[model samples]
Target: MRFIIIGAGRVGLRTARVLRQEGHEVTLVERDAEKADRARGLTFEVVDGDGSRESVLQDAGVADADAVGALTGDLNANFAACLIAKHHGCRTVMRIDEDYREEIYQQYADEVDEIVYPERLGAIGAKNALLGGSIQAIADVAQSLQIVLITITDGSPMKGYTLSEVALPSDSRILAFGKANDPLGIPLPDDSLEAGDRVAVLAEFSELTEVRQLLVGDESAAAAVAGGE
Candidate 1:
């Protein structure tokens, strides 16, 4: 897919790099001459103008873009770029620094296809690194729910059990499971739960402790693993 990114800052540059790595085309719009030149130095096709302006967007080929991301630090500019992208019939994605504004922006979310809080994502990553658990939080889905990746430990009671036999907590559900190094797949009722396998689960915060205890064994086991890290 073709994407137009409205910024040449860290997030915009990284996003373009990953999309390009996934075989997508990207054009970046940056008003800062130095930032635009830096992006160009990295071989990125950059439009040297303000992304919030229609004329600048037109120069970046917004009409031909499949999607446009307003990823600048400036929320007003991001919103403006998204509105123009929407007008051009392109999928719009807006980035915001503050998660506190999610509710306010969500009210007008129809203007953009997606709204993301990079700070919240960074918090999740940091939490995962600091929290020593068999279950590492991948995302906070809602106020009380989390998306987690649970690793079935070598000595876990979950080993040799099937999905249904595991009798997961009421507030938790297994999304997928497979070998630790393998991509997750649908958890068949009869599929064996092997040690070192990993499962992605959606779980309530309150139920995570029990969920970890069941799959990872005891607190001692969790502590030992943390100690080794």
Candidate 2:
């Protein structure tokens, strides 16, 4: 696959390197001469110009790209670049920095292929830091869903339960499970949940509280359930 990434910043550069390492063709577009020169040093094809401009993107072969990631820190530039990429028949992903504006931009998410929130993910990291132990968010699957890895502690309601016997909220389901220290893999129906084992679950945004309560009995989960009233 050929990917054109706008912005030669940390996110764009690292994304290009990883894609290149996977044997995909990657081209990076940057407006700054210094950044373009820096990208060239990394052995990636670099285009020095404003990514938001159609001509600049065209010069980077956006029309032939399998995918385009508009990852500049500037939101407007990223959005404009994505529009151009979408017009050129490339699947597009735009990086958004503000969480509050997510819903407004998400109205156009279907027009593009995806939207990313690196800043919001950083916030989630901060949340995990404060929450400490047991529960950890793995990724935001969508605006209303999250994939999380939870450890089964001794007092967890899920501890000692079999995979087939655990009751998840209607909006949630277990995606995978594995014993602690084991290579993470999909859980089998016969597998029993043991203390120290880890489970990965996909839950709707509204059901996260219940899901957490069932797993770790966290106070926030209980509070959420109460507040839902």
Candidate 3:
């Protein structure tokens, strides 16, 4: 696959390198002379000009690109680049900063093939490290909902139960299940929950504690359940 990346800054350059490493051809477009020269120094094909301009993108071979990644910090520029790329029949990926509102996301989401939040992804990695080993946050489904993976431990209340026997809170639902050392897949009714097994659940923020108590019982889980009484 061939990819055209806008901006030679941190995110754009890193993405270009990864794609090149994976045997994909990558080209970079940068408005800044210094950034363009820096990319050229690393032996990458770079077009020198504004990525949002149709002529500049044409100079970067946008017509031949399989995909376009607009990863600059400027949201308007990113969106413009995506729009121009989309016009050329290329798949477009637009980068959005953390400062954007939900409405802003919704507005641009419909116009691009994909929207990427680099800062949010980094924060999710840090959050997972702080959340400990038994539980891992997969994604934020919405402002009030999250998808989490719970590893059943020996102390888990549902450790020896079957999938059909497990009951979650009203706002939560089991999404996938996997046995020890296996990959997660669609949940099966008769699949037994054993220590080391994993279950992925989507739950509202308010119901997370209840889901944790039922699926990942620990000392804190017990305390949370007791405190609610």
Candidate 4:
């Protein structure tokens, strides 16, 4: 696959590197002389011009690209680049900054194939690391819903129960289960929960405490893990 990425800063360059490592063709458009030189220093093909300009994107081979990632920090530039890519029938992925108002975010979200908020994703990862323990937040599905990974411990109330017998809180559901040292998979009705087992659950934010208590137990252990860091 071929990709045209707008901007050559941290996010754009890192994304280009990953795509290139996977054997995909990548070209970056960077307006800044220093950034363009930096990307070129790493043996990347960079077009030196404003990414919002259609001519600049053409130089980066947007017409032949399978996808375009508008990853510049400038919201207007990113949106313009995505609009041009969409006109060329390319899949568009636009990056949005954390400072934008919710209404503006939603308006632009409807125009692109995908929206990425790097800061939000980074925060989620940082939070997981900080809250280390038997329970970890996997993702924020929405404002009110979250996906969490829970490890069954010795004191867990559900440790001796089967998947079919465990009753979770309202609006919560078990998504996947895994035995100790094994990869997670679809939950099985006959599978029994035991110490060291891991379970992935999707629950509303209000029900997370109950889910954690039922699956992990012993809150002090989790607190100790976080405090030790």
Candidate 5:
């Protein structure tokens, strides 16, 4: 696939390199001379101009692009570039920094293949590191919801329970289940949870404590459940 990345800064450059490593072609568009030159130094094809401008995008071969990612820090420029890419029949991904505007941009997400908040994702990583558990956040579904992956351990409440028998919080749901070192799949009612098995679940913030208690009976999980009493 041919991808056109708007901006040649850290994220753009890294994304391009990874795509190229995955056997995809990548072209970068940068308004800054230094950044453009730097991208070129890395042996990437770069269009030296403002990516939001039609002419500049045309110079970058946007018409032939399979996908276009607007990863610059400027939201307006990213949106403009994504709009042009959409018009050219290319899949578009626009990056935004602020979490407050996630809902506002979600309206445009269907139009632009995706609207990503890189900073928010970084913070989620830090948060997962801070809260040590068998359950770690994979992604934030919304301001009040998260998608988490949990590995069942020995003595875990979930172990030995079938999908139908296990009870998660009201606002939480298991999406998939898998054995240790295996890929996750849709859980079946007859499937039994076991030690070393993993489950991915979507959970509301308020129900996180309950979800943890159901999966792993840790001290913190017990404390949280007790505190709620």
Candidate 6:
């Protein structure tokens, strides 16, 4: 796949590197000479220009791109770049800093394929940091659903419980489970939750608190996890 990234800052450069590592062709566009210079050393093609402009996008071969990632910090610029890319028949992904404005932008979301919130992702990171090692939110799915990976810590209420014995909230379900060294797969009735085992669960936003209680034990466990640095 050919990807055109409309920023040369941390996010764009990192995206380019990961895509290039996966053998995808990537082109990075930026307005700053220094940032463009920095991106030139990476695996992607680097173009110095204002990505919000049609001419600059044309120079970056956006018309021929299979996908475009508008990652500039400026929301308007990112939105404009995505619009141009979408018009050129490229799949567009735009990053928005403020998640609260999502509904307002949903009107234009059809023009773009995906909306990303790095700040929300950062909050997940902060949660992991504070939690120490028990539960981690892996991804935020569409609507209020989320995918989370949680470890069966010592003395957890879930420890020794069978797949069918564990009670999850109505809006939540365990998707997969595995022992410490085993490959993750759908949990079976015979499978038992043991210390150090990992489980993946899908839960709605409102049910997360109850789901956490069931998986992590109690409010004290949550407090201990949340109080960590």
TM-score, every prediction: 0.88, 0.83, 0.85, 0.88, 0.87, 0.90
Which candidate comes out best when scored by TM-score? 6
How would you encode candidate 2's per-residue C-alpha lDDT over 1-229 as one tens digit per residue?
9999999998889889999999999999999899999999888899999999999999999878999999999988998898889889999998888776777777846656787777777667876776667877887777778888888888788778798898899999899898988976988988898888999999887887888888887644633321121
Off by over 4 Å in 5: 108-111, 219-229
What is the number of residue pairs that collide in model 1? 0
TM-score winner between candidates 3 and 5? 5
Top-lDDT candidate index: 3
lDDT for each candidate structure: 0.84, 0.84, 0.86, 0.85, 0.83, 0.82
lDDT at 62, model 4 = 87
10 residues in a row with least lDDT, candidate 2: 220-229
Give the Å error, residue 223, model 6. 3.1
CA shift of 106, model 2, Å = 3.0
Candidate order, TM-score descending = 6, 4, 1, 5, 3, 2
List model 4 lDDT by residue over 1-229, tens digit each. Answer: 9999999998999999999999999999999999999999999999999999999989889889999999999989999998899988899988888635434665746658877888767766777777666788787776678888888888898988999998899899999999989999999999999999999999887777777777777663344222111
lDDT of model number 1: 0.84
In model 5, the Cα lDDT at residue 164 comes to: 90
Candidate 2 lands at a TM-score of 0.83
Better of 3 and 4 by TM-score: 4
RMSD of each: 3.8, 3.5, 4.0, 3.5, 3.6, 2.8
Query: What is the C-alpha lDDT profile of model 3 across 1-229, one tens digit per residue?
Result: 9899999999999999999999999999999999999999999999999999999999999999999999999989998999899999999998888635545766746658878888776766776676667888788777678888989999999988999999999899999999999999999999999999999999887888888888887544533211121
Runs with alpha carbons beyond 4 Å of true place in candidate 4: 99-104, 107-109, 220-229
